[model samples]
Target: MAEKFSGKKFSGKTVYSGITMGKVLILRKDPQIRRVKIADPEAEKERVYGAVDRAKQQLAALYEKAVKEVGESSAAIFEVHQMMLEDDDYLDAICHMIQTEMINAEYAVSVTGDNFAGMFAGMEDEYMQARAADVRDISVRLVRNLSGQEEVDFSAMEPSVIVADDLSPSETVQMDKKRILAFVTVHGSTNSHTAILARMMNIPALIGVPMDLSEIRTGMTAIVDGAAGEVIFEPTEFQCSEAERKIKGEQEKLRLLQELKGKRNETRDGRTIQIYANIGSVSDVGYVLENDAGGIGLFRSEFLYLGRDDFPSEEEQFQAYKQVVQTMGQKKVIIRTLDIGADKQADYFDLGKEENPALGYRAIRICLKQPEIFRTQIRALLRAAAYGNLSVMYPMVISVEEVKQIYAFVEEVEQELKQAQIPYRIPEQGIMIETPAAVMISDELAELVDFFSIGTNDLTQYTLAIDRQNQKLEDFYDPHHKAILRMIRMVVENAHKCGKWAGICGELGADLELTREFLDLGVDELSVAPPMVLKVREKVRGI
Candidate 1:
């Protein structure tokens, strides 16, 4: 059933209210890309196992030209593409092909039992869509390398919005931020790197525009109102006026937020609440400092592992960690090391496909099994401590035994650091009180760590046994459910009784209505998305 909506415009603006037959923004993309078959299915064709290496050399040349012509950061964007070409598992199959030397791209790719590479490229999911660019970027670079083509000068390219099927992290980051007005991808999510980078750059962007967005001409005007999740294609007279008014309103709200920015988050009666930023990368470190956040309440170190094709080196990890610490200066930055789980981890380490991944291999369970991987991450974090106040946090700590084991490992690394005379910093360590077992051990767990940060998103999922992402149980996953609030109160009050602080770095932290309840429950700190910082601060201050 096609239901159309009609409503009067809000008092201050004009609107095109009648239902017109056109594409609408509802998370689905416009003119979905037709799946492409990369390799031939049946033939005596051969594979080039060393094709990725050829791709790497090509990317290096392109990057060299990019670095000299553009800024260093623009060139640095190619690292992931370079890393993709180096994926051992991905390249291993290519190397082990059994056939003649020459083959078509399809023949080369057809050796695999499953078309994971093609499927990965075809996915609508942001992270997975990013892989598409990775595969293609490497492929294109290899083609150029093999052809001995001269690199194009990036300096002369004019800034223009890219209208394409989709973009990978590498592809999105490579474009000139100054030149690109906005990205009109036929497919993507609000959380996609394309959307995220747009927000970061303050560029007006609309994702998932319906009906062949690529066909939208080069100079056609578009109003990418991401907040409203809509795009106005060559807006009408009424739309022009309407958009101007909405922009004014949004800008006024932002102005009001700026007025409240940097102001202490305290109640009129003198109750103080610590406001912090929830972050995953060094790029976010600057947001915390600029916004006067009390500290980085939840610094997810997963970026070191998440979204990467390979594990980052200890020194490489340290450089990223040290950047955050140095940028933070004296304030504390709590770093949560590698929170990969079977259910949430979209990585190469196949843990035997299971029916229910949520209840299976995840968090501490996966980390404990991969001791070498865990130790390397811990060692990198410890080394990063030499720069400033850096605290190590463990995620998905489910039981007393798990906490004891990981804490013991931490001690082992500390002792090893001392013996090696490695200069490093080790701030107070803590646990993410997400799992029910960990929450049950609040008193005993608090004794083991410096503080507690409640991951309400996971806690809600585990406690209610409702996967928020499932959409089916979204109704049952309400944060306001009595059971969830009770559990939150139980965890918060328990932490306080144990003389420890409990902070919220979950989606609940930013919900305006729930903010009061969270405050009432005595949450010591609130870490939120960057956009909500000033609003939450203002709301908390008035309370």
Candidate 2:
């Protein structure tokens, strides 16, 4: 019989909601690197280059696999890894260390990886800090390839709850999804790629669990209650029974939600509203269709610019937009132009540091100043609009002047496309009402756009003057304040007065507590995360 111990419980942050009980599978920690003196520096340098080539190949395969499993937005991390492998600075540092110390390639890679990862970890930006894990992941792969070590194969393993210090994106993607009952980690961020992948896989995952590896043994019974953010070791028979009951409840709830798929999003009295899905990439289109979303309300185009150096080409942007619009067919696909800056930064932009980036240069400010970049995206968007129903929306607009400037760029792009004899159409244009300034002037702003999509996340942050990213302000941050509801009502009234449609494309849109209030306010649409589509629809039906 397997060794048994008294039940112990630990808490963590929930990344996904579900319940499962299984044996514990402790993931092997990082490999130890032994620094060996090499006989020839040149030979070692050649060996390092060879291993990099092999790692690049492996990453390329991983990218394709991830794209198939998770979608392009989540899989883009692998592409970033491939770029990191090719980075001249990273490769040069590894080569310099090997030549200077006459050390083996594996040792050089391990040290350089730590140094680079440390630099990222020390950054003030959370997104940059997350890149530290990426650095470590790529480094580990190179080391394994150099040492002829094989990756852990979970394909043959029995279903179990995986316990790890932290899982990298690559490791999570490589595992067999069917074998993963749940994931419990000692350390990880909800914003990390691994967490994102877990959600996409629809697996129960708990992060930041405080547990000692020595206390966990393979085959030991474990229960992961992701909804409660708790992990129970050597769970008692009663605990297992309760977990099984919760699992069945979840399954029954899902079955009921699935029944609402083909049903219309209409209230009991016949008040119908468009229920759409917010997507980050092309891969999310499948989910949108699966959830029976009437259309895609927000297709965040920034994913194309992220995870890469330099700007995405006009052709690249065109193909991406085209794929989405065509795939969605006649269904409305509203694509927001690049809303880079703020927390989402690309090094190539050289945006520089700021004391208050959230209030400074970003979104429409960057696009207006950098017309060339704006033109490239507009040109692609217009060309893609020819294929199907597609509309464009600008983010961070606070004035009539900004909207006017955007139209001028749109006209210029339209003319260029016409001159080149490219098949294109000027799609319906709109602006995001995210700022207090926009809300106040929405009456005037509504006349200039075809529609309005309220980005409640930023609107709430700006209206409340609270940093949404700050944990310390969590106590005071209230999205349902009377002021916000008044603002939404005001914006909706303004849009309707101008014969324009308005929709909520923020986190609040999915808040079931306020669903009836939003409907009463005459909000025309609610675009939420894909999984929330059916639930929101169910709420609407009950209302």
Candidate 3:
């Protein structure tokens, strides 16, 4: 008879929320490499160069696949990988090692990758430290290509919980997503690309699990409780039954949410609100539609500017906007004009380093100073607006003069299009009420724009003088403070007095605890992450 084992449980940080039970699929670690002497160093250098080329091609393909699967923002990591491969310093280091050490290509790559990765790991900046994983990822790919080794064949495996020491962006993207029940890692960070992709994919994932790989075996049944951040191995019958019960409950909830599709987002008292979804790319429109969002309240257009060498041409921007506008089919699509700079830096922008970029030359500031870039995006938006329902909003606006300047630019673009005899329509214009100045003077700003969208994330940060990115201020970063609610009420009332509709497109929009309060505050709409649409709708109905 088989020996019985007691159930063991360990806690970790939850990357995504949900519960899943499946067999354990422990991923093997990378193969160890040993240095080997090469008779011809020059030949090995050529081989290394060839491997780099192949790696680039592989990354390009992965980029295309990821774009289709997860969307552009998440897929941009592969593009970054391609650029890293082309970096002269990185390539030169590998070549120099191969020639000077007279070693095989794989050994030189392994050593150089380790050295560079170690350097990045030692950096104080979290972003730079994250690049250590990228270095290791590309190195593994190159080593595999040189050795004629194949990638892990996830396609042939059955659906199970994916257990790994840590996963790189490439490895996470290349896995057969359909076969993955959940991801459990021994070591990972919430800021890691793998974590981001897992959340976007809507797969339950956990990181920092303190478990010994040797003690676990493949095919052992395991339970992943993402909400509790716990993983149970060889779960007892009672634990298994509880997991099954929770799974069934979740399935039932999903079924009921599906029924809410095509239903009105109206409260019990006949108060109606528009529930829209915020999206970063065209690929995310699928989720927006699947979740039955009334429309896209915030389409972050900056994704077009990121992950590229230079500005996206007018036609490129037009086609992207048009595709989204047309797909929504009469549903209002509010595209936020490039809100780049700050934490989101693009190399081609040549934006000099700033001491406080969040308050520096960004958003409307960059647009006003650089009219050529602004005109390009405005012209494209105008052309795309001709196809379907579309509107544009400017971020970081704090003055009437800025609004007037934006109007002048839009008029110039419209005149240019008119002279060229191009078909277009001037869509609705709005500004994000993110700054304290914007909110305080919202009454005046309301008259200049067609609508208002409250961006509570920034408003709360600026109002409280707390950097949202700082973990040290977590205790003080209270979004529910009376000050924030008062500001939202002020903006909504101001917009209403001017006969303009107001909505929220921030994290607070998805807070179920505040949904009733928002409705009572006379807010017209709430735009949140796609996954929260139904839950918010359900909450609105209950109230």
Candidate 4:
């Protein structure tokens, strides 16, 4: 039975109802600044620069107005765009176009956006594609406002589920998370922060939904299940009752799983298994430490970079890493070095261009190219190592030579630190075995790296020759594909043969069907989504 109260929270079971949005994605674009030379070069120069300056100031003013309405801390994230507009390079890039290049302001913004659009189009990573969208969004807003178009309203629209091509940082914060049920976007992948935000808020999100927002009417009922990628619109009573029952059963299962936390996860055959949450922030470490997790399976460093506009300093990264290591006390923390691909790492730092970016430069590949960034992370890992057991893992390893090259650099840094008489710990080194080539040579890779963690997301995609981002094949990209399971089994068996532990750290590890398969294949550990932890543990314990 259901009863309506002023406040919402039902204890009997979790009933996820109401209108949930799908396909929510962020848009980022910066309008072009025009530079025109009408015979009088100096006169034209002053005019163009003035327009650029005025446009910058206008964005700042709009943001200031926005902040006064929203709280200070709540608005800080949006204000970064204003700051970016004021950057000396950004300003000069526009101002110089008018004086030296003789480009019009509108055309300049248009040219910049066009160039970026073309560049992003050639790239393979989905994260870069979304950022390219952001570039276009921010550019349009700037150009429209500078052209004296009606000032766009910054007011908060009703907290309806946002159905968009994508969501931007500004668009996401403008949305009240409590009221926004879900995001349905014509475009998006798991990489976008909009989808991540939806996941964090426990809201259902479906990306690459086959419909457009114009089809949706306000208050029209809908169903959104992120796991199933299912969205039902204008459901019948039978469907509603079925949805309710599914949610209720899931909740009851969750309740039972919660009861099992702090209980050791062991098979009925008396084999003990370690299950841990893959955390990023220090607080996540704290949150999971209270549970029955064996430890933090994966501490992703990208969160530190993505959380800010500028690159985090070595000391800053060190401290954050230290917090997680120290807090977990004796629990193990397997820290993965900067997993952000150049395509994925969308901060102020631009590494350079690439071709077939998915297979090009990313993770350890990019880190190796940018040793300064890689070394600082290694240094931080060494320093944080003093706090507890720290396992260092490199992402996107495909070749044995690349692994050796990374090891050489790591050893060089350790030697330099030794020569400098610095005291720090060097944790066990490992590599994320994700690529098809790596899985094929798992036995050899196991002989090299300290341990191996299967990043099944990329592995499956690479093996199947299917782009998960392409909605056309979304229906065909299955983790349980026979080929994928065979690859997983090969890696696990190789790790055991070489006296190295193999763990699954990707989404497939959290999936129900694959969990049993991994157990049967003899996985040493599994790091899954937080909510999936207890359930996975319960499943393992019962067996």
Could you give candidate 4's per-residue lDDT for residues 1-543 as a string of tens digits?
Answer: 012211111111111222243222222223235555445446644654555566566557655754654334334545655554555655565556555676556655556656656677668765455456545654565566546652333254445555566665556645445567667666665777775565444466666666545445445555565556566655656766776777777677657777887788788888866797777556455457545678878877886677444666778778878878787788888999998863476545565567676776678877888899888888878877878888899999989999899989988888977888877887989999889999998889899988999998888878888877665786777768999888888998999998999899987887777667788889888987565677788888877
Deviating ranges (above 4 Å) for candidate 1: 1-58, 61-164, 177-211, 342-352, 474-476
After superposition, candidate 4 runs with Cα above 4 Å error: 1-80, 83-160, 173-180, 215-221, 232-242, 280-283, 286-291, 307-309, 342-353, 418-423, 474-478
Q: How many backbone overlaps does candidate 3 show?
A: 0
List CA RMSD, all candidates: 8.4, 4.9, 5.1, 8.6
- lDDT by residue (283-391, candidate 2, tens digit) is 7788889888989999989867865546788988898899999999999999999988887777667788899998989988999998888989999999999999999
On TM-score, the stronger of 1 and 3 is 3
lDDT of 3 by residue, 1-543 (tens): 013444889898887778999998887566567789888988898888888888888888888888776556567778888888888888899999888888888888888889889999998765677679788888988898788764555658899899989875546657776788889999977645566556556678899899887778888889999889999989999999999999999889889988998899999999999999988777778889989899999998887786555688898789899999999999999999999988777666878779998889999999999999999999999999999999999999999999999999899999999999999999999999999999999999999999999998788888999986575787887779999999999999999999999999988898899999999999999998787899899999998
* After superposition, candidate 2 runs with Cα above 4 Å error: 1-7, 20-60, 63-109, 112-139, 145-149, 154-222
Q: lDDT (CA) for every model shown?
A: 0.64, 0.87, 0.86, 0.68
Model 1, range 1-543, lDDT digits (tens) per residue?
011112112110111111111222221122122233434422322224345565566578657766554334446557667876667765555434423333444334433313445778677565675566456545555444333332333344455545556676545434555666556665666546665555444455654556443335444445555555455565666876777777777678777878876578888878777887777667766666656677787777765564445567787788888888888888778888777664445444445566877787777677799988888888888898888888877888877788789878888998999999998767778888887877777878877777888888788888888875464675666787787777778788878887888888776787789878888899888877655677788888878
| Candidate 4 TM-score over all chains jointly | 0.72
lDDT of 3: 0.86
**In model 3, how large is the Cα lDDT of residue 325?**
97
Note the clash tally of each candidate: 7, 0, 0, 37
Model 2 root mean square deviation, Cα atoms: 4.9
